[model samples]
Every structure is written in C-alpha cells, then in structure tokens.
Target: MTETHATLPPGAPAFPPGRYGRRREPRRRRPLLTTLLVVALVAVMTLVSVRLYRQYGDPNYDAQVITYTGITDSQVLVDFRVNVPEGGSAVCLLRARDRDGAEVAREEVTVTARPDQRQVTTQHRLATTARPFIGEVVRCRPPA
Candidate 1:
C-alpha cells in the first residue's frame, strides 16, 4: 500500500494564521495627589470625630431653661430642667442678663439626682444688681 500526503495550492499559505493572540491589559497607576488627599481627609475626619465626642458626646450633665418671670425690679424666678446620672449631683450656673447683654446676676446651684429619676425640674430666685430681661442656664456639670 502507498501512503498519500495533502498538498497546498501554489498561491495559498503553507499553514493557516490565527486572527488573535495572547494579550496583556494595561496597568493602572493611582495618582499621588489623589491618594494623599484621601489620606488627609480621613485623618481630619477622625480628629473631628474624636473632638466632637470629647466635647459634646459624654453624658455628664445638661440643663435647659423652662420658664422665667420677673418678680421684682431686682428679682426673678426661673424654672429650669436638669439631667444627670442616677444618684448623681450636678452644679449648674444660672445667669440673668439685662437688655444690654450684660450679666446682671450669676449664681451657682447644686442639684441632686433622685434614685428613680434622671431629670429634675426646679425653680430658683435670682437677685440682680439691675433689671434683667432674660434668664437662662449657662452650663451644668457633675459636681466634683
């Protein structure tokens, strides 16, 4: 028996060529300025969060003015609300300001927390050197 072999045409290629080959994708590089900006933003945000927590997040004490009425030219009655921890005592600063924004009277009061309550409402009288147009609580904090 004789073996037969395939032959190519005279003008045809000896072997067929493929239309595609292995290719590598382009590498992406992050911008240095953008990376630095992102890092700075994160750092600033972290610092701001910590500062805010330290300043206003803690549950030390709080005070709010409920009402005020002028009793006399130099006297006023103020009703305010105070919040503190259970069985805690707080010191609050009350101020009476005149129409010119000057503090005509200032006083500090100690408030005690009840065993079953976190908020307390009380009234106090303030004696001012001059007539006051407004009375408010300046601040309240746990007694040292």
Candidate 2:
C-alpha cells in the first residue's frame, strides 16, 4: 500500500500540525475616537431631522375633517376644523372620494386668521365629476 500527502515549499511555515486550516487572529477594530465621531455624527443628524420637522413638518398647526356636512350630485360639502397659531392663516386641501376610493374632486380652501381663536371650523365645497361618498380635509399649511 502507498500513501500520498500534500506538501509545502521548503521555506514556508506549515499549518498547525493537528489543524485543518491556519489559525486566524481576530481583526483589529477602530479606536474610541472613531466610534465617538460616528456617534456624534448620528446625534447631529437626529437633531437636524427633528429641527426640520418642527420647522416645516406641520407641527405648528393641525387639521381634521370634522364631518361630511352635505353632498350633491356634482359637489361635496365638508366641515373641517383647523388649529393655528394666533393671527395665522391656513390653506387646506379638501378632497372628495367616491365609493371606489378614487378622488373625484380636490379644492384648496383658505381659512382666515383669527387672532382671538386658536381653533376654528370651516366649510369647503369641492366640485366632483361623479357622486362623492365622503369628503375630507386632506392637508393644511401656512399660506406661502
């Protein structure tokens, strides 16, 4: 009987005698300064995100569809509520949807500023191509 074995070059270090593969040392990791820098970057990004949301993301005002006040064959009437800063006005998008959830009409309505009140209810009328099943206030924002 004869046995055959793989061999290494004369000057090369052999693998550990009893192991199937060479042992590998654990990889080095970044130092504390690099980790802290990444953490600081993430914190800064989070702060900026919150600041931007507060500035332009509807935090200063709120809008809600109070009720579907009325409807006609070609128009929908909605009563919605808005809360705004004192003396600030809000422009709202009122939309009407049919039974299939398709938007039948959309209208932009503006609520006048009321320094004496923070919340107000307003009516909006949207013209539709078909009969509307529901009416809603889609969005409201400060006038540009």
Candidate 3:
C-alpha cells in the first residue's frame, strides 16, 4: 500500500519538502523622542529673551528742584527738572494735599526727549485760612 498527501487550496503556495524558516515583520517607527526635543528647545529660548529684556530696557529717573517762586493769592510756582533715560518720555503729575490727605489740586504734564532740559513747571494754590498744603511730584512713563 502507498501513502498520499492532502491537496492545497488554489492560490496557496505548496510547502517545500525541506527545512522551514520563520518570517519577520517590518519594524515600527517611534515619534516620542522627536516631540520631546522640540518642546525642550522652546523652553530654553523663552528664558533667554526674558533675561535680555530686563538688562537693557530698564528705566531710571532723577528729579531736582529748579525754582520755588511765590504766586498771587498765596499760590507757589514750583518748577522741577525730571531727567529720564535718553530717547524716553516722562509723565509728571503734581498733587497738593492738605493735612487730612485730601487732594486739593492736581496737574499733569508731559516731558519729551531732551538730554538736558526742564520737564515740569507746576503751580499750587495754598488755602489762606484752612490748611497748609503739601506738594508731591510723581513721574512715570506713558503706556504704549
């Protein structure tokens, strides 16, 4: 008696009558490493920009009394020189307050770019009978 092998279906490759080897699939790619590198670079650049801005753009101001002359009706003409960094402008607000901290008079002035010039010439009227007035000069930069 003789032995017979089973038939394979259509379009199927017949097994070779010899030793067999295992097949391997294609390798997969990973994206996690690339994404992490980009995030790290952005964080480093932001820190560098903040440090540079703090160094160069800082503002410094100096105020000096120019003159204090008396005006009529007991008012005084107080002149001041506000010096700011070159090419920068200053906004000056003059305020007169009474003993109770209430605002009696206020004035606003703008000083433009001048290396050596006066900025503000303000006048405050003191009450003849009520209370003595205290004057204050506040200077700042205008909002962009």
Candidate 4:
C-alpha cells in the first residue's frame, strides 16, 4: 500500500508531492554517549564484584561436604569440613537439594578453629519442606 522513497525503483511511479508525508532526516549516532554508558556499566559491575568477593569469596576460609546422610521427608544430615585461619572462626552456607535439583533448604552455620587447628569438621541437621537427595557446604567466609 505504501513505500518509502529509498525503497522505490528509479522508474517507479510517485504519488503527488503533498499526497503523503515528507521523509524525516535519519537519526545520528552518539558514540560518546554510548561509550560513557558502557564505561559506567563496567565500573558498577566491578564495584559489585569486589564487594561480593570481600563478603563471600575469601580464599582463607573454605568448606567441603564430607558426607550427607539421614535424608528424609522433613530433614537431612550434612557432614562438612571447613578450613579457617588458625584459631579463627568462619560462617558457612549449607544447602540441601531435592532429587530434581531444586533447593530444599539453606542455612548458615558458624565454625571455629582451635589455637593450633586450621581445620574444623561438623555436622548439621537441616529441616526441609520436601525430601532432600543431597546436602552440601556452599561456602565459608569470615564471621560478620
């Protein structure tokens, strides 16, 4: 029913001068604005990554799940080992998942190291809404 001047063939018949509407000028690109937006986005992401790393990504405190047992409709038993600074303490994240890989429960547990000990082992019973297939230690970080 209609076509733009740019899309018409050279010999294509044209409508009357004022029958339709005038073609507007093409939009101009703003490289500077785009560059500024990109830089700002990168800066914000870097800041967030740094903040998260400081809060939850400490290399000194690490935890691993040793074994999971006692799985039932209402709860699961999680056995884990965590390594922290000698004589220091850490807070660890514990998670439980159902057979379908859906998270069933999560909790934070605190662990401490003895004067000459850097590794601490513990177990926790996590109450869940559904039957859990596995339990794990997500991470360990410095106590808040």
The candidate maximizing lDDT is 4
Superposed model 1: Cα runs more than 4 Å off: 1-60
List model 3 lDDT by residue over 1-144, tens digit each: 221245656665655554355434876766787788888999889888888755434345455556545533434455676666666676666655566886665667666665554343333333332342555665544424
Instruction: Give lDDT for model 1.
Output: 0.83
Arranged by lDDT with the best first, the candidates are 4, 1, 2, 3
- Model 3 error, position 142 (Å): 4.0
Query: TM-scores of all models?
Result: 0.61, 0.68, 0.40, 0.64
**lDDT per residue as tens, model 4, 50-79:** 999887777789888999999999999999
Location of the lowest summed lDDT over 10 successive residues in candidate 2: 1-10
Write out the backbone clash pairs for model 1: none
* Model 4 Cα shift for residue 31 (angstroms): 20
Top candidate (TM-score): 2
lDDT of 2 by residue, 21-92 (tens): 555798888799899999999999999999988666885568888788568879988988888888788888
Which 10 consecutive residues of model 3 have the lowest summed lDDT? 121-130
Model 2, backbone clash pairs (residues 3+ apart or across chains), number: 0
